[model samples]
Target: MPTGLLILLYLVAALLPLGLAWAQGLTPRPLVDELASGAGILALTVILAEFLLLGRYRFVARRLGTDIVMRMHQLLARGAAILALVHPFLYTTRRAPAPDWDSHRQFFVTADFSALWPGIIAWLLLPALVLMAIGRSTLGFRYETWRMLHGLGAALIAGFAVLHALRAGRYSADPAMSIVWLALLGIALFALAYVYVLTPLVQLRRPWRVSAVTPVALKTWEVSLRPARNFPFRYHAGQFAWLNIGTNPFGLWENPFSISSAPSAGPELRFLIKELGDFTDTIGQIKPGCRAYLDGPHGHLSVTGHSAPGIALIAGGVGIAPMLATLRELHARNDPRPTALIYGNRTEEQIACRAELESIASEHGTRLTHVLSAPPKDWHGATGMVSPDLLRAHFSDPEHKRWLYVLCGPAPMLEAVEDALIELGIPSRNILSERFSYD
Candidate 1:
């Protein structure tokens, strides 16, 4: 319903002015038309961008593979950027030389700098965002660094844009226009509040203490946290949480780690994190008394969403995180659903939680298939990655649509598996892939 409304709103927004121009039979000023259209487009773009960045909305997008939503967002951002560039050029008579940062800084410090002042700052901040979005591969910027800068840069942009709009005399002059602008600003603030302020604040007021931080390997650790007080979040077997370390609410260092423990294990939340980057590597170092803020129970790549009589589970390396939850749920429910897991790793030594997986499989009557890409000479399991032929030969009724494939792994592996599945005549919708970003 919201999706339909957005489309309808966009159509109306796009056509309303043209209709007005035709109905009034007045000479339409091209610059005015452009400016108006640009404003509308900019407003919509900023709203969607803000929405996608919000925790709840972002979770929904992740679950639904909200690519269409993102496409709309990308389109709007590009259009807004173009319109912003053209807006100044088109209104040449009204356009003045852009003041340098030094000159503008004093005006910005003054809270009364008009609605337009905020927008001017937003305009200045947008280039960095646009560049960063395209600068992932280049610019010598790692994903983590890019993400941090993006968040900081976006906040500044939104703040500045709001200020600019409020200060700009045209929109600011009318009370109703101001109200509408304020309403949009309020919604943005609400999202930010829910993610950063309200959620964390509530959690902190009623804390969830760190239970343990145990090392699984040289670089991987399992950090468990359980509620010290009443907690409302009831996560599915495979969902994750955004853990904020060091009592820093605005730190924005939230990372999605799969709940390594089963939902049947009660309120105790577990996360197995590999020390690959700056965040996970140091997770073991966090002291027991240190306060941690959590903001999730997100990601819907769980048994709850899929209801097939049988299941094909695929994982690579640490991608087995969600499968832990899925297996647990299956075991707890006594779901006689025959499930097969093709867990892939580089070597036998790196096969994490192997015993736990085998035990669960035994208890639930689920079969475990180990695929070692680069195993030792004595390795007895499948010698290579999961291929269509291997799957077809090993599994019963392999070609049926009644079986759902839950794939979670590195992007390259997942892509290959998806391609292989398609080649074997399985429908794309029957295959679900979980995006496990170490970001």
Candidate 2:
């Protein structure tokens, strides 16, 4: 689906409960009371919808881009937390038992402890959950441990919020609104199950084995995976996948990596991994033939349908993984479009696949520019960071602005290059980029 249509559907689904509540035509309360109720309802619905934005669904992630989806997840979680925190405080109506003539409690908030306690608990936990997620890396927990905690915490919050709404909400007293709350809760739980249970079950049937592991550069290794059977893994160039090596398919040890091999190369998948974290630091020790699993083909970095007359690939350090895939795929298809690659690293030793990059440039008529920030004394190529000045020197032509520019790298480099490209008159939509760090 197009991104705009997906957004429209999301808004309609999220606001459906609020619309139903408004249709009930209940007695009017103070403006503050109405605001409180509306806030709570919207927050609950947004929280429920967050499960689908976690980037596990290909229909959403592939179409909108995984980075955008994950970004939406983070922002929506924070927004819901704020709304949930202030929901009860905004109420000015009295919380007391309904009088004899008001047995339905249409004019006052519920005073029942059972119904109120769940709301209190969920309200208190929501902020803590958001804080933990924002500070996950600094809290001394492993990525897998933090991921599991985040998932479980979100599930608990959703359950508590639903219980509070069904028991204490005045509008939820209506049968239709009650059913809406229950349906939303059920959908949230099913999303969790689909990601954690069903996806792993499907992966079990198409397992892969590590076929080779070779050192490609300083602290970098190229790992290859071949299917245990005749399973075919279909993916576009410049996309990524979550890789689980030598572990249970359902385990939480997976990490995302861009596929370094072109899809046209074969069914076997290859990844260029740099040693950075705990799992990555031990990658070189992984033995061939170990079981592996891949959940992927995510991201929107490919240039498949682009109409640009040329392509420009800008990569920094290990970010070249996806760029390699793009270049190889273009070569395999014998594409006639002009191509240029500007790859930068701290030193020459850190450059991975140097020989292959040279071969591709020679064979495919690509203009390859290598930049080293800390070059040896005898080094002769560009010897500074990939700054705007360097970009202007290479891509100053007006025609260059019309060419598609794809970038992947550290956060700072990606930001700098993206800004420079826009300043150079390249349309933002024509400049595709993927950042390794979501934060």
Candidate 3:
């Protein structure tokens, strides 16, 4: 589906309950009371919808890009938390039982402890959940532990929010709206089950084994996987996958890595992993022939169907993973398009797959430019960062502006390159980038 249509569908799903509630024609309450109720209802719906935006759903990720989906997930979670926190305080109505004439309970908020307690609990937990997620990196917990906690906490919050809505909400008493809430809750739970249970079960039958793990560059390893059975995994050139090595498929001990090898290169999948976190730092220690599981072919970094006359690959450090995939695929296909690669690293030692890059440049006719921030005294390549000055040196030609620009790097570098490209009159859509960290 088109990205716009997917977004439209999401908005409809999130706001459907509100529309149904309004259609019920409940007696009008004070403006503040309505606002409070609306806030809570919207928050609940958005939280439920977040399950689909967690970057696990291939349909959503393939259409909207995993980076974009994850960023949206983080931002929307904060927005939902804020709305949920303000839900109770925005009420102007007194916390009392409905009078005889007010059968719909529109004139006053619920005083029943059973109905309000769930909302209170959910309201209190929402902020804590958001804070934990925001401080995940600094909390000093393992990534897997943090992920498990985050999932469980989100599930609890969704359950509590749903219970509160069903028992205490004014319009929730309507049969249609009640069913809507139940359906939404069911969908959220199913999403969790799909990710944790169903996917793992499926992976068990199509397991992969680590074929090789060799150091490629400074603190970076090239990990290769081949199917344990006669299974073939299909993927686009620049996509990524969640790789689990020497672990059960059901565990949370996996990390996302770009498929540095091209699909045309056959069933064996390769990942260029850098030493970053707990899982990645141990890549070199993982022995070959270990059991592994892959869950992906995610991201939207591919240059497959682009119609640009040329391809410009700009990468920094290990960000060259996807670019390598694209370049390899292009070479394998004997693609005749003009290609240029501007790869930047901190030092000569940090440049991954240097020989392969040089070979591609020499044999495949790709214009390769290597940039080093901290080069040795004898280094002869371009010096300094992948700044606008460096970009202008290679990409200043008018024809280059119309070429497809693909970038992957640290957030600062990606942002700087994107800004410089836009400043140089390259259309925003022509520049594609994916961040290494969603946070």
Cα lDDT, all candidates: 0.65, 0.91, 0.90
Give one digit per residue, the lDDT tens place, for model 2 in 1-439.
8989999999998999999999988887888888999999999999999998878899997778887888888899999999998998997777887677875565777888999998888898889999998887788778888889889989999999999999999888789999999998999999999989988898999899999999999999999999998977889999999999999889999999999999999988999999988689999999999999988778888998899999999999999999999999999999999999999999999999999999999999889999999999999999889999999988889999889999999989999999998899889989998764556
Clashes of each: 18, 0, 0
Model 3 CA lDDT for position 407? 94
Q: TM-score per candidate, in order?
A: 0.78, 0.96, 0.97
1-439, model 3: which lDDT tens digit per residue?
A: 8889999999999999899988998778888888988999999999999988889888888877788898998899999999998888999888898888887986778899999888888888888988888887788888899889889988999998899999999999888898998999999999999988998999999899999998989999999999999976889989999888998989999888899998899999999999987898788899889999988878999998899999999999889999999999999999999999999999999999999999999989999999999999999999998899888878888998889999998999999999999888899889888874545
Candidate 1 Cα deviation (angstroms), residue 350:
2.2
| Residue ranges of candidate 3 with Cα displaced over 4 Å | 436-439
| 1-439 per-residue lDDT for model 1 (tens digits) | 3546655665664444334334433333455544653464355345434544443564345545433344555555666565555543444233333346523221222234453465666666676676666656567775567767876676666656655655553324345545555665666666655665677676666567787887764466778887767866677776777777665655667676778777777887778787766577678788776667776776666767677778888888777877877887788878887888888888787776777789988888888999988989988889788776776765535545577888888877887888887777777878877653321
Q: Which stretches of candidate 1 lie over 4 Å from their true place?
A: 1-27, 31-36, 43-49, 58-120, 133-149, 162-178, 230-232, 246-250, 287-290, 388-399, 436-439
User: Which of the two, 2 or 3, has more TM-score?
Assistant: 3
Q: After superposition, how far is residue 280 of candidate 1 from its true place, in Å?
A: 0.9
Best by TM-score: 3
Candidate 3 residue 189 Cα shift, in angstroms, is 0.9
